[model samples]
Target chain A: MNLDELYQTVILDHAQRPRNYGELPQATAFAEGNNPSCGDEVTVYVKLDANGEKIEDIKFKGAGCAISQASTSLMTVKLKGKTVAEASKFEKTFHDMMTAVTLPEYPQGFGDLQILEGVRKFPQRVKCATLGWNALKQALGGNSSHDPVTSENE
Target chain B: MINAEQLRNDFPILHQQVNGRPLVYLDNAATTQKPLSVIETLDHYYRKDNSNVHRGLHELSNRATEAYEHARRRTAQFINAASADEIVFTRGTTEGINLVANSWAFDNLKPGDEILLTEVEHHSNLVPWQLLAQRKGLKLRFVPALANGESLDLAALDSLLAPPVKLFAFVHISNTLGLINDAKQFCALAKSRGITTLIDAAQSSGHRPLDVRDLDCDFLVFSGHKMAGPTGIGILYGRAELLEKMSPWHGGGEMIAAANYESSTYKPAPHKFEAGTPNIADAIGLGAAMDYLDKIGRDNIAKHDMELAAYAYEKLSQLDFLRILGPKTNRAGLITFVMDGVHAHDVVEIANTYGVALRGGHHCNQPLMKKLGTPASARASFYLYNTKTEVDRLAEVLHKIKEYFTR
Candidate 1:
């Protein structure tokens, strides 16, 4: 219910100036995430290391509400340089944080992503907060299918 | 004039607060709040005459069937249909359109026949035809909206209404843009060409007085919920001759006159189309809603709607950062706009903090949004109960939202 909590200063800043934005043409894996209800869409592109086991870089390109854009922007900053398994683990943790009935204790090493926990209070916006993470999860899930990942299905 | 302040008292839900603020329900286009009469009607039906309609011989069954049939007659009268037999009940506007598409178009149209629609149709009006076109090898054409994104390009109608265009289906009002199309003129044009016409009056029915006879459209569809009735009830009015020609879309209990394992004889037009046990209680509730609206006078309500929309549009236009969609004048009871730096969802979310409910998204008009050059926009729709003061509140909240996002 607190507007300040939902639109944290850090989240707003990230949304205004997203990190690692735009297409990664040399990317190995990429997937699009869409929230059809609100018309929010983001494509997360991942560049894995030589072994294809670790994400060397991650980037995104799309337009949406601040929660969606910022969550994806912050996600790129968190997942880069982490192994695919670790990224998947973080995704599960992030999903839990967003979907929890009450504010769970902040998971360590989540960094600025903790600001998104405010999304838990607004049930309708949970999809907006998770849209980007769902795409990143899809990119790393090895399907790399052409069909855009939807938050509704996840 | 209808006193909105007095009318607001009839809606119990409008008195509540959201997030510690008085709720300003500007989402009327999505669904209008039900009146006490409608709510009581629903309760009365379930509490007293709760039985299956059409076939029951018991006292309750007779009451239920009479009430259900009375609702059908009320709907026919509400829209000024030539006869109650012309009215078919469906889940809502979407179901009504799908019913016509499946029953009428499926039987009549041939492969390569084109259906003329507007660029501004809601998905309900567009998608059914798309599915039908794919299935029957039919072609589809569109009448584009003007560059202003308000009115349909009537100039283009002549070219699009070529011989192959068998049916011309369009929205009576743009749910997103709030533009009221000239249904009468459009219907006349289609009729002159000997092409069948269907009007999507989902937005127009309760907000304004409607006469299917006056519009002269072969088929017209509208939802009860949009007009202050219960959900899951709507009307599809077809001309008597046309209704007789169309086959039944849903096959079940009430639609049949005689049944055997191999085949069954179907009832007349309206009953034949309505298969299974109908939404008896809600249909009766819709009748009550029509009574309530009639008491207030739909002409007065229509004037109030336009006044509220015009007032809201002026208030919103004062903000330098906002770009309003739809025509500047003669719009329905709504305003759709986008803030310069704020996403529509964010605008809606922040406005909720102030208890001003708004609709933000494609509003089931994705292609129209694309043409208008915005992914989505925020809309504040008014009804009979909404007032200029609420429009002021909306404008104030929008200003605060702009400052919050920009600062």
Candidate 2:
């Protein structure tokens, strides 16, 4: 019931002024994710480096709650320089954490993403924290070039 | 006069606390808290008369049959239908609408025929026709909401009632906007044009007086759960002649008079629609809910609702951060709003911390949400058992949410 745990200062700051919050004009990959229950939508656009394996640039544009927007913003920062495989691994780790089955030891480099681990206690908010990650996965997985892939919490 | 505080005692579910604070339930539009009268009715039925209706020759079957049929008669009187035969039991409003869409409209409407609806219909009232239109190659036209997003445009409605428009369906009260339309006048207009009319009265039947004979709509639908009754029970009031003319929606035992290897003949209007063994206990519980509401009186409930809505609107509007939806005048028993910087989910989360339950979402009116240009909203709906103190608490929680998010 503690509101501060869910709406941490970092979360609110990222929600208010999200980093890399714009449409990527030079994007090679794109996907849209929606939490229809709460109307949280995030569109992720990624511009991959030559060879199309490493993410050269990533940006997200959408509206959602503090947790979702903050998670998306933080995700763009953490996954920018990583290869597509690394981003997918990170997404799996984050999903496991939100689903409350993360390993005790942190993955090699969790960075600021640990702040969102508090969401594990709030079961209803797990979907909010993972919406952006799911969208990012959709962007990196194949079919990003064909149609704007859309994903839901369900 | 209905004393909400006194009536509150009758609902045992309201006495609990959530998250260490007194529970303030404002989600009445989604479903009402079942009163002890309804609960006890269900208990009594299950305890003594738990048998299949109109099937067995045992004493319990006879008792169950009598109770279920009596419940139908009570439901007919509750809505002031022309006769009990006109009231067909369905799972809920969604099923009732589907029944009509499948039985009446499927048979009556053809390719190029149009069904007139409004922009503010819930998905239940809207989606069935959308599916039917796609399947039958029927055309659908909408009467757009007025500029305020509260009332319907009568002028557009008149213009759209051109030739080949077979039926007109609309919600009596918008669950999202909390605006009550004049169903009688709307029905009269459609009736004058010789168009079949249906009113989705899921929100209105519990909060106001409903007279099917007075409204004269060809079809009316409402749910039991929204009226302090059990779930999985609702009524579909169709004109006797129209219901008789329409083919049976679902085929099964209770709906048929004689069945053979070759074919089957159905019963009269009401029985012909109710296919299988119905929700007998919940139907009896619905009767109990109606009896309870009748004692309180729907007119008084309506007044209580309006007073609560007006009070909440006046209070919540003071917050510059909030934008209220629906009519400023002559609104229904609920208020839906969105905060300037706060998402409705966040607003609901903080309100939950304060032990207040407000519905936060599209409210199954996704198209209407798009029309309002907001993805979702926080809605606080009132029932006859709600009080000004609860409204005040809601306002206080909303203020706290605004202050919490803005700070």
Best by TM-score: 2
Global lDDT scores for all candidate models: 0.92, 0.89
Summed over model 2, clashes come to: 0
**What DockQ results for candidate 1?**
0.78
* DockQ by candidate, in order: 0.78, 0.77
Question: Pairs clashing in candidate 2?
Answer: none
The list of candidate 2 runs beyond 4 A from truth reads A100-105, A145-151
Error of 2 at B332 (Å): 0.8
What are the candidates' interface root-mean-square deviations?
1.0, 1.1
Candidate 1, residue B59: how far the Cα is off, in Å = 2.2
lDDT of 2 by residue, B1-407 (tens): 68999999999999989999999999999999999999999999999899999888999999999999999999999989879999998999999999999999999999999999999999999999999999999999999997648678888888887678999999999998888888999888888888999999999989999999899899999999999999999999999999999999899889999999999999988998988888999999999999999889999999999999999999988988889999987878999999887889888888998899999989998878878888889999999889999999998898888778767
